[model samples]
Target: MSLFFKIPFDKKQIELAIESLELQTSAELRVYIERKKKNQHFSAFEQGLDYFNQLEMFKTEAKNGVLIYIAYKDQQCAIIGDQGIHQYVTEQFWQQQNRLMIDYFKQKKYNEGLINIIANISKELARYFPYQENDKNELDNEVIIK
Candidate 1:
C-alpha cells in the first residue's frame, strides 16, 4: 500500500510543502511536481485544464491501496486507502485561509495572502505525517545455517 498527495500551490509553496514531508519518519516517500510548458498554443485556462487531465492520469497510475491528497487554490481534495497512509487533510485548512485572507485584505498584502494559504496547507500536511517511534526489537531472531 502507498500514499500520494498532490497540491497545486505556487512553485515556492510546493517546494516548502515537499521539504516538510521529507522530515517524516517514512524515508521512502516519493514526490513529483507537475510542470506546464510555456510555448503551448493554448490559453491559460486551457493549459490548466490540460494539467488537471495529467493529474487524473497520475492518480490512475497510483492504483489501489494508495492514499492521495490534492490542494489547489480553488479546491482541495483528498483520497484515502485502507491499510495505507491515514487521511488527515480537512476543511479547516481552507477555513484558516479565509481568515488569513480577511487579514491580508486589510493589510493589502496580496502576495502574503497567497503564501499564508499555502503555509497553512503545508502545516496540515505536516500534521498528517508525524514522527513514529522506531522499534527494532520486534524483529525475529531466527537464523539458518547454510
Candidate 2:
C-alpha cells in the first residue's frame, strides 16, 4: 500500500502537458495513479476500462478520450482509448506505446517517458481529431492520484 506516495510529475507539469496537447486536438487525456490494484482479478486494462466509464470518459461528444492508468504497488499500467479513437488507430499502436513505456520504465525515467508518450499520443489524436474552433475542453486535464 501507498508505494507511489511521490510520483515523478507534479500537477502543474501534467496540466501543462495536457493543456499543450489539447490546444491541438479535440481528444481528452487523463492519467490515473493508484497505490495498488483495487481488484486483483482484473488486468490493468480492465481496471482502466472500469475507471474510464466511472470517470465518464465515454461521455465525450466525439467519444474521444484516453486514460493512462497506473498501479504502482501492483506494477501494472494500462493506456486506453475510447471507441472513437480506438477505431482509427490499430492495436499495434497501443502495443508500441506500451513497449515505449516499458523501456523508459526500466531506465527509471517515469517523467520523461510519460511526457514522450503523451507527445506521441498527441500527434495521433491531432491527426485524426484536430481541434475545432468550437471545440470545448471536454475533460479535466488534472492527473488523478488515488
* Best lDDT among the predictions, by candidate number: 2
- Error of model 2, residue 26, in angstroms: 0.6
Candidate 1, residue 51: Cα displacement in angstroms equals 5.6
State the lDDT of candidate 2 residue by residue for 1-146, as single tens digits.
Answer: 55546766566776788888899999999988787878889999999889988999999999999998877656577889999997797789887887787677767777777788888989989999998889899898889888
Note the residue pairs that clash in candidate 1: none
Model 1 misplacement above 4 A: 1-86, 102-106, 130-146
Q: Any idea what lDDT model 2 has?
A: 0.84
List the lowest-lDDT window of 10 residues for candidate 2: 1-10
For candidate 1, lDDT tens digit of each residue in 20-139? 443442211222222233324754334433443443422421121212222223222233322223244444544455556546645655345544544454445446544346512211
How many pairs collide in each candidate, listed in order? 0, 0
Instruction: Point to the candidate with the largest TM-score.
Output: 2
Q: List CA RMSD, all candidates.
A: 14.1, 2.3
